[model samples]
Target: MKQRIITAVVALLFFIPLVAIGGMPLQLLAAAMAGVGVYELFNMKGLEIKSLEGVLAILASVLLVLPKATWFNFLPDTVTNITLFYLIVMFILMVPVFSKNSYTFDDAAFPVLVSLYVGFGFQNFILARESGVTVLMFALLVVWSTDIGAYFCGMKFGKNKLAPHISPNKTIEGALGGVICAVVVALVYLLVWPMANYNLLIMLPLTAIFSVVGQMGDLVQSAYKRHYGVKDSGNILPGHGGILDRFDSLLFVFPLMHLVGIF
Candidate 1:
């Protein structure tokens, strides 16, 4: 418990500053996250990655965040699609060349995983910034509320398991508590400063639904760790575990917010 507090404090101390600075700093932070995440994704034991797979991962990630081709006039069209096709074309063209390491199909999944994890997940932050910081802040707050609320509620009153296989710690009662806390947080934020330019009536419910998504995100990550026989993704973030651990909910929430136009 004491260690968790210290970890949370240290994380906030680092996170608040980077978020406050915005712009390139934020981009750099996202890039670093993507790079590390991709590296970890590729590091799955018994997984085989091709020589150009790393290049594809980086390309997919950058293009996802980069400015639209409309600005440069010389930029290529369908950038994401083209890069994806590069994979398909390469696989089909080179299948005969591999006498061994026949698990090409398995290795290919890593790039897609990395591409989506870093691209779609982080792209929402860019969109959120354009809309307003409050947009991002609220999304983040709800995720936190869920995480905090669930922990306390579960320990005290939880009965039914949320996902016994993936995450034994989670409970259905805890999930309800998280929903309640998230709604309360949203209402308080609304009272403090009414959000403009978005429909709260619709957004409130959507945000609650998104809180559920974030919890599932945590569950999925936990399941991955369980499968790999690891306690966490990496040891880079002290008690937090890894970048993925610190931002699991954020990763799920960001794309959801973008889809709903709340960010």
Candidate 2:
């Protein structure tokens, strides 16, 4: 518990500043995080990060993590980020053919899937930040509140399991508590940092929905970790596991926020 708290403080100290000063630094940070997330996902499948597929996955993720504005100056208008991403995917698929089936198509699929998952997720994060710091922080608050609320709520009032197979510790009661907590925090957040677009009524239900989506994202990560037979994604953060472990909820929330016109 002590280690967890210490790591959280240390991480936030380093992370918050970059987030506040959103620009190339934040973009770089996002790209690096996306790369690490790709590494962790690849690690789960016993794939080598130094391998060709791993390198390509990391590259794809970093490309996706950066905002389209960054690409505008260098990349020709003719070729989009999607085009480049597809090219990388084709290269990954071709690896098996050149290697005479040693690195099977099955092996190639994992990197591509992980790249898209981690990549687009982080890309949305950049998009959120680009929209406004308040927008990004709002998403963060929802994810963090949900996680904290679920932990304590489950310990105190949990009776029914939410998903016994994926995450045995979670409970339906806890999930509800998390949504409640998220809505409350989001309300307070709006009170302090009022956005022109969002009002109390609009935010109330949206917060609950985001909380649920965030929990589902966490469950998805838990499902994969269970399949990989690992306790945590990685030991990058002593108590927090890995970048993917910590950012799972945020990844889901940011994209959903954009989809729902929060951005």
* Per-model TM-score on C-alpha atoms: 0.84, 0.96
- Steric clash pairs (candidate 1): none
Q: Model 2: per-residue lDDT, tens digit, 129-236?
A: 888999899999999999999999999999999999899999999999999999999999999988677788888888999999999999999999999999888889
What does the lDDT come to for candidate 1? 0.72
**What is candidate 2's CA lDDT for residue 186?**
92
The reply for model 1, stretches above 4 Å from the true place, is: 46-52, 66-103
What is the C-alpha lDDT profile of model 1 across 140-216, one tens digit per residue?
88999999899899999999998998888889999989988998998888777567756668667876898899998
Measured with C-alpha atoms, the lDDT of residue 16 in candidate 2 is 91
